[model samples]
Target: MTKLTGAEIASHNSKESCWVVVHGKCYDVTEFLPEHPGGQKIILKYAGKDATKEFEPIHPSDTLDKYLPAEKHLGPVDMGTVAAEDEGVADEAEVARLERVSRMPPLSQCYNLLDFEDIARQTMRKTAWAYYSSGADDEITMRENHAAFHRLWFRPRVLVDVERVALDTTMLGSRTSVPFYITATALGKLGHPEGEVVLTRAAAAEGVIQMIPTLASCSFDEIVDARRGDQVQWLQLYVNKDREVTRKIVAHAEARGCKALWITVDAPQLGRREKDMRSKYDEQAAQVQDSDDNVDRSQGAARAISSFIDPSLSWKDVPWFRSITRMPIVLKGVQCAEDALKAAEYGVDAILLSNHGGRQLDFAKPAIEVLSEVMAALRERSLDDKMEVYIDGGVRRGTDIIKALCLGARGVGIGRPFLYAMSTYGEDGVRRAIQLLKDELEMNMRLIGANTVADLNPSMLDLRSLGLHTSIPRDHLADQAYDRLVPPGLKAKL
Candidate 1:
């Protein structure tokens, strides 16, 4: 690879000819301008200079490899000859934050998932915290997602030989060390510099599956390539309005050896997340609307990028998705039994009973509450075994996993807690979180008198109060801990 002077690279900065340097390597992204997912304006901002800083945080290392042709790889640039931009003064607020964080307890002191959330809230940037922690409307469903798990009581079988419990399981036919996989969460860079790649590393090390989010800061190939050996990965697709774009994305994931395609069925339109919305609700958005570029990125992170998701996605499109890839198709946000039967009718492989972690519809039913109804509906239609079922939202403990499995869930997914862990302590935090769940599963399974996940049955759980909507006070101390960690403007309505 021939090294080019920085001056030579800078000469190609125009819409007609754009060359940007990332991590000391120059690439001619001239033809890729229109194809950029974030819109061409973002690339144009750093058109003539090193975009490493701007690109590194939001993009996976393999983004160029996945999107650019081999011919566009224009070798390296000479850093010695580069005219460095004026290093601007740091934000005073940021300095104060770093100083504050320096005085806090170390990551090792953080014991559980909720502890990680508290640490992440203190350490993360305000915008990031708002985005990760916010829920739709009054956040009733978010509270319910956690509370519903507590409603179900475990019926521990006595006098059963409970030695040697196995936490390992298969998700969508892929082997995982734990029954739970790291469910998809978007804009991971908002929490950590490495973004979703941090999750990829952690999942691989911990022997679990990682479902890569379509809106991830890291591109699909980057997450796939980050796998250690044959570690499994699943792709979570937020179908683009453009069918051609959807087709290409599906093909790419399948080609990259993704084990399954988990299409998000909710989010036809993004929910009004007050916390995220309020972050940019001030006069800045209006001021920026009149800028040279017509792009309005000020609507906070969620609204800014969610514009591309297809509102027309329907049951008809399921067949179209099936045609595009050989990977198993799973609907990610089925909230009712009727929809669960419809999913079986569509002949898809699975459905994750979820409400977008209560980030979507306010006061939506928790996945666990709907599980019994979905199972009964499937059984009536003789479709109970036709499609595998899973649940997510407020899964903090192995006991939560046990409850879902007892109710006929093939597996479970966990999202926000892992994000908080990643934000607080990076990969090590995630690794510890996974280990903690395994330890809990071992102990809980023994106490519940289940040696294997298969040993868990509906009879083993007392679900008489599961269907009730009444508030069940389980752990006020943990609730208060999370309450303190909530972002300032957003109040928990539970």
Candidate 2:
């Protein structure tokens, strides 16, 4: 394989014949330009240049090999002869963010998960913060996810021995240290350079399960290999339009010892995350080509990478999934009782009641609310015992976990909080976050007169105001992170 000179590669640097260097290798991406999910404009900006810095965070290491044909994999580039990409004037926002990072409170000061989020909001890059914090449309559902937990007050029992409170629980036949698992979130490298592997190591240290996302910045094998002995992992999948691609992914996950297959069912199409879209637009504005490009610029990172998800996925595909692997199948993102019952009927091992962390379907009920309804409906049909039930969305504190378990949830999934921890302080931060939850869980259990997980039941919760959609007290930390929505044509001056 001959190494290509920088001058030779630079000559093919237009829409007609584009080439770019990534990780010291050159690739002819001219044919792939139009097919690029993030749009051709981003690719054109890095044409004939080292795109490694831009590419490493958002895409998996195997992206080019998996998506691009072998013919386009040009030989290595002699980087010594390559012209260095111009580093223009420093961004003022970035300067401020760096100062904030320097002034961030020590990890010991973060007593709770929200504290990590508060710190991350002030320290992360603008695009990264926007992508992680933004929710669909008005973000009413996002706020309501945490707020709904407040609606149900606790009913503590007295005159009961609470000397030993146990938080150990099992999900899908796996015993975990706690009843919560780190749920899947995409683009881990956007927050931390090490990506999902950081969560993997943290989960291992804390003795909890980690659900690896299909869109993880680190490759699947990288996360799996990072696991300690007997550390459990589950795969969260977004079904691809190509059946073969989906099959290959499922087969690979099972072969890599993933314990469960969580099929995301709610997101046929991603919701409009305005903050992310605006952030992306701002970054790309200076790079816009003079020509009328057909690429959609309004979609942020969410839509850009999600174009391969099969919108036609239906219940009929359940049997096909079962045929592919023996791993326990879990239907993630189930929002209603009807769907939960249907999932049980389809013979899935579990159903995770979720609304995509309120990133999909703006008005969708919180997973905790949906959990209550589903449990009732399932018990009515004598199907409550048919499958393990789990819920995710706005689970910030141990009290939230208690509420779900009382409502018949086998366990809960927490996504954003852990990501915030990892973003703010890496592996140590994540471990601290888990420890804090454990501390809270034990204290809450002892107060509620529960000695073990089985001791928890619906009797421990007062559901009188559970269904009311009333406003809760203002959350200063969340409000600070939130980007308030403005009415159309009423943009406020920044």
Candidate 3:
């Protein structure tokens, strides 16, 4: 219950006794510095100052309370006497960024999901953009996620009554307005201040489900509280190393009325996203000692927050998860048909065919491609109807959603596009993005002579070229968002 002046906290700013202000409270993090997953440098930079702005985007509000011992909670600080940190002059890069923001095209101009990415790349901060946009090394899978869709040409039917097309569909026993839901992506505050709650509100407006991430900037209750009446939300969980912690999280989510539990199975360890690593290298490398072997300096933001994920998670744990919560269990990262079969045998409610948005493994087949193989394998075993199947990654257009549905997907999940939309224009941006997809879905369904989601079939697609990995035309909008890797020596020149 102690209330200390800013100067008192400022005096203990050295490595021997460091203190930082976050959300008007003072925390003595000196002892915890060496164990920081982000490396010690970032904390040292804000050693004696207010780190609220830098802290809010990447960390949940309960982070300090959960990780730090109660003794480290040094109580509130007197903000009236706090020394105002100097606002340094903006560099040329910042000036250019501001100019781009000023010139950002109107939201009405964002005709499709790609348009949001184009604007986000030009306007977002360098670090934020890097974290959100970067995929695994070489980013081949990331590009291929969208490219694979182009290979499957649509077989539009003619002379059929297609008026009054219906886009309504049910996912995990819940009826939704559209066949696609806003999928989970971490660090929502990195793009927008309100974080996951922004997406929650947007999803409610669109009558679609929102999957809240395990590493969201906002607390779990904050996002759950943001839901409107009967607005369903699912939890995307990264199982923690501590089973007790994971169990508690599951119980709390179920108590809060979460409709499903999406257990992410792909990321045992964070993938090496070069673009994101490069963005943090300069800031982190100089702060740590070569003798200090514990800190991993190269992982950037992804590594910092994901240290607790249980790499030992396996099929054996399925029964344990079932015991914890009755919310429908979904294996979120099954890449191959074999794993898909295994998931079905385990009696999971669903399997989300994804490669973690191509962020986990480079060269991993796109989710759309995997969906075809899995659906075939499931049908062969008479297990296709046993559980719902969903796919995410590179789902941008309404046609993309149609393609997945035609191939036996109950629904599709779209992640990055919504984040990009929210990043550029807040909740309104997210609403517009969903509305655009709805428009495209209706028009495409009508064009393909499909009156309802049930009308979509594999027969409506030309599958001969779906498996071919041939050269395709360049994707200009995607290319614009991609940051080409630069050699270390050339980094300074840029």
Q: How many clashing pairs per prediction, in order?
A: 0, 0, 0
- Candidate 1 RMSD computed on C-alpha atoms after optimal superposition onto the true structure: 5.2
Q: After superposition, how far is residue 194 of candidate 2 from its true place, in Å?
A: 1.0
In the range 411-468, model 1's lDDT, one tens digit per residue, is 9999999999998788999998888888888999999999898899999989898978
Which order, best to worst by lDDT? 2, 3, 1
Please list the C-alpha lDDT of all candidates, in the order they appear.
0.84, 0.90, 0.89
Which candidate number maximizes lDDT?
Answer: 2
Q: Which ten residues in a row have the lowest lDDT in candidate 3?
A: 485-494
How many times do residue backbones clash in model 3? 0
Give lDDT for model 2. 0.90
RMSD of each: 5.2, 5.4, 5.2
Greater lDDT among 2 and 3 belongs to: 2
Q: Any idea what lDDT model 1 has?
A: 0.84
Badly placed stretches (over 4 Å) of model 3 are 281-293, 473-494
TM-score for each model: 0.85, 0.93, 0.93
C-alpha positional error of residue 203 in candidate 3 after TM-score superposition, expressed in Å: 0.7
